[model samples]
Target: MSDSIRLDKWLWAARFFKTRTLATTAVELGRILQNGQRVKPAHGVKLDDMLQIEHAEQVWEVKVLRVLEVRGSATVAQTMYQETEESAEKRAKAAQDKKYYREPGASVAGRPTKRDRRQLDFTRN
Candidate 1:
């Protein structure tokens, strides 16, 4: 591995993002923060650097443990960073809450299905 890796590359290698493009987009949109500040996708990621990542309504605070440029298996990628305890707890709590209380609009993905349309029409009548 190299001495340093780009932030977007590191995020992909660490399994935080499925693709480098997504990582770059997230960084550009300020979804990824390095040491409490937003940084460009090309920013260098060093060992032990703190990163706060907000993805899909979940937030993660991880400390870089290894700098890698290549994306690897999930098990290997997991070792690249260490998530803080507080972050883990918060994620768990959020997951639990999501399980119990779902948004009313969560089931709406696209146009209503045939049955849904019928139901809607019946309600309108």
Candidate 2:
């Protein structure tokens, strides 16, 4: 591994974003921060650097454990960073909350089947 890497590249390698463009966009949009400071995508990432990333409606706090230039498999990418304990707890809580609340139509599962629609129509009358 090199001594450092660009923030966007590291994020891509770590699998935070599916593509480099997405990573760059996230960095530009203030969704990704380094040591609590906003940074350009070209910002250098070094060992033990802290990052706060917001994605998929959740915020993650992680420490860069290793730096790599190339994107790797999920398992390998995961090894590049370590999520903070608090972040993990917050993510878990958020996931639980989302599961309980859910989207307005998640349970509906798209348009109702004909039988279900007929039942609804009968009940409505």
Candidate 3:
């Protein structure tokens, strides 16, 4: 494995994403940041660099403890990096808040039905 790794490759190696394509897509969409600045998937990452990754409804701040060019097992990936304590706490608090403040009567999955759409319109009006 190389000492420096591509941002997308590292993300996949770290188990943050299932595949490199997904990580690249996220980076292209400006969802991944390095030291608070947006970076491309091709960006080179070094050990100890801070990464702020935004995925869906959650944000993560992880520090690169190791850099690997090749994908590795879950156990190996676990040793590749570590999330900051503050970031972990923030994530947990945000998750708890989201659970409590979730939209009432909202569908957890899939698109809304016709009836649901009508209800939404009437509620807005």
The top-ranked prediction according to TM-score is 1
Clashes in model 1: which pairs?
none
Quantify all predictions' global Cα lDDT against the true fold. Answer: 0.91, 0.91, 0.87
Candidate 2, 28-91: lDDT as tens digits: 9999999999999999999999999998898999999999899889999999999999999999
Error of 1 at 37 (Å): 0.5
- Candidates 1 and 3 compared: the better one by TM-score is 1
In model 2, the clashing pairs are none
> For candidate 1, what is the TM-score?
0.86
Error of 1 at 58 (Å): 1.0
lDDT of 3 at 96: 92
- lDDT digits (tens) for residues 25-124 of candidate 3: 9999999999889988899999889999888678889989998877789999989889899989999999899888756446535787888878777767
TM-score of each: 0.86, 0.82, 0.81
What's model 3's overall lDDT?
A: 0.87
Model 1 Cα shift for residue 71 (angstroms)? 1.0
Instruction: Give candidate 1's total backbone clashes.
Output: 0
